[model samples]
Target chain A: MNVPAATRAIVVARIRKLWPVLLVSVAAALFFGWLYQNAIAGRQAGGEVNLGAPDAWLLLPTLFTTAIAVAVAFACTSHANRDPFALVEDAAPLFGRERARANAIIPVTIALAAAAAQYAGARLSPHYATPPTFFLFNAIAAIAAMLVALSIPLRDGAARILYALLACGSTLICTVVALAVIGFTNGVAAAKAGLAYYPNFNDLWGGVAEASFAALIGFIALRQYGEALARYDPLPPANE
Target chain B: MAILEMRRASFARGRTNIVAPISLQLEEGGTLHWRCELAQAGRVLARMAAGIVKCTAGSVFIGDYDPKIQPVQVKRLVGFIPHPPPSNPFDSPQAYFAYRSDLWNLQCASAVERGMRIFLALHAQPPNLALAVSGALLHEPKLLVAENLEAELFDELANLRGAAALFATR
Candidate 1:
């Protein structure tokens, strides 16, 4: 569909309007990457678990999630463009436009700062935290912004996908907490230590977090394409 | 049966009266020419824009029912074109004709052939005057209301001595 120039302009305006959300999303990916490269990937795990393995495939999900964050940012920009958030000159600002600009940006910067803080915080306090838990909180927060971006007004597809990932995210975080308690109290016996030594699904948690973030961002970017598909994204029929 | 009745309707923009209270009666297969001066075209075109003449205000019976209430409903059976100039920025006359064909609900495929022929015959380059517009006219309209057309289409009017024989109805 050839989005009229007028519509495209509105999208840019919306992006500027919602710049903070996008900033935080992109910032989260960078922090996630930092955690993967510096925190989890650095530590020595069991030979089988392989957190320190060279060229580990663990970074895949982190990259994926980063792409998704970009997509959501682009979509938010595109949607605003698609419908100019304009009201009658005398009327109040449009729905999403009403958010405080300064406050919004502050949170975005703070969110990124928090993610970096979390990643470094975990790397320093490795005994108290597991690799999965370190990445999991960042994942949860990145997922939160995706949920918020997609849940605005009538569009909920973003929200739905974010919700599903978030559910899976909760399960992963819970497992990490359980492992930490087990490792702390009973002590690291050979078998238990081997389990920790050998890398497991917890590593995948960090990877998946990145993958999810990037996928969301990539989708939004594609949606911004001018003269794209002929139809508005009609959600698939209920049965489909 | 009379298709429309304007009744003494007057439309205004602010204090200016664009079109005064004008009344006219139309029936299927009826063709009438205003034969008024050049400025009258603007007034008549305003009526087309107002949805009063083309659809409502008057008893406008195109095919089955009165179109006064169903403004868009009249579009399938009717097509309108205002004089072109500043409004059309398209590269070629055909470019706009093709776009407007779908936009105005006219046949698109044949528009290319018809547009080429019409522009070639009536409108040449040097002077480039938008002499006349023909849409759904190739098939023949039951009634055609054209304003400010050149002398060439005078006989094309359905009531003209040489033309009424062509449509056999309008």
Candidate 2:
């Protein structure tokens, strides 16, 4: 088979294997979104609703998208890394690198699809059209997770687990720092004024955080891919 | 001219030398049995020939292509079947062969025809064994590197000595 044909076959097989997980993640997001909307509607009907902030409308979907994206990214990466055919396939000409690159595309596509669905669902209600910034940040966060997942080496159970934990923790910490800088800039009063003047500033820090995380992931993945190509063995020496 | 050649080639795994420096050459239509007491040595040799493992010292060449520099070309010229034959419980031999053929870029019709011929010739053998041997031949590789072939298959291949090169290790 030619390069394109081989790549297409590999990607199709991966998607087929991951269909169940993707389906469940999207379905769960939609279900929870529906419930959240209903809860808000009930409170508003009883005149007991205290919507804290207008941007809060975007929080539910953002969190849902991030959670789902991270979960799917982790599952896809872990499965690909541990596949029985990994070493054999990697040894094949043009197959290994193509497979690795193709694997990343699946999680990114799924994350984007999930984000779109959430945005569209939120649009159905008044005053709930999420800002474009939210969608952008969510997509970036998901892509960042996928890149981090793909950057990890395979065949080392303990190392894989540790790297995964560290990656997640670092991403979370970076995001919080970005949010704090944006939320506390020039004191809370000036931050509130800035948000009022430019509403996108409300979640601007989220986008910044995700963008930086994606850049870091991209760097790590490049290095890892280079090392993989140069190395003879997939696993490190048993001694170390 | 040798179709597969190794010059003082040695391989090390985590500072432990698996293959001591050895030089060998096999012509286009020759057979070589790499007799070694260690199964790991045989496995490493097959992988080196197939470009799956790199030689730490000296060099390896398949025809004019160096496996280290032109791995794709070298791999195309060699077919390797590791000992015990890699198998998946979920995959039938037919499905496995089909996938292998695609990966190797073999013409589907020709691969199928060759597979059938091998199957008929080895009809008395176990189905999986027959299939595994036939699957490796689907691409009509110039050199076949197998590990621990049974007597029956060895005899069958011996009859075709003039048609292709064969290498086996135990």
* Candidate lDDT values, in order: 0.38, 0.61
Q: How big is the positional error of residue A222 in model 1, measured in Å on the Cα after superposition?
A: 23
Query: Measured by C-alpha RMSD in angstroms, how accurate is candidate 1?
Result: 16.8
Q: Candidates' TM-scores?
A: 0.34, 0.69
User: For candidate 1, lDDT tens digit of each residue in B13-98?
Assistant: 34754445555555554544444332433434333422323322333343444434444444343423222212233456665455
- The TM-score obtained for chain B by all candidates, in the order given, is 0.57, 0.88
The best candidate in terms of DockQ: 2
lDDT of 2 by residue, B51-119 (tens): 767898989888879877777777777766655654442245555555566667667667767777876
As for candidate 2, its clashing pairs are A1-B105
Q: Single out the weakest 10-residue window by summed lDDT for candidate 2 chain A.
A: A231-240
Worst 10 residues of 2 chain B by lDDT: B85-94
Fraction of native A-B contacts kept, per candidate: 0.00, 0.21
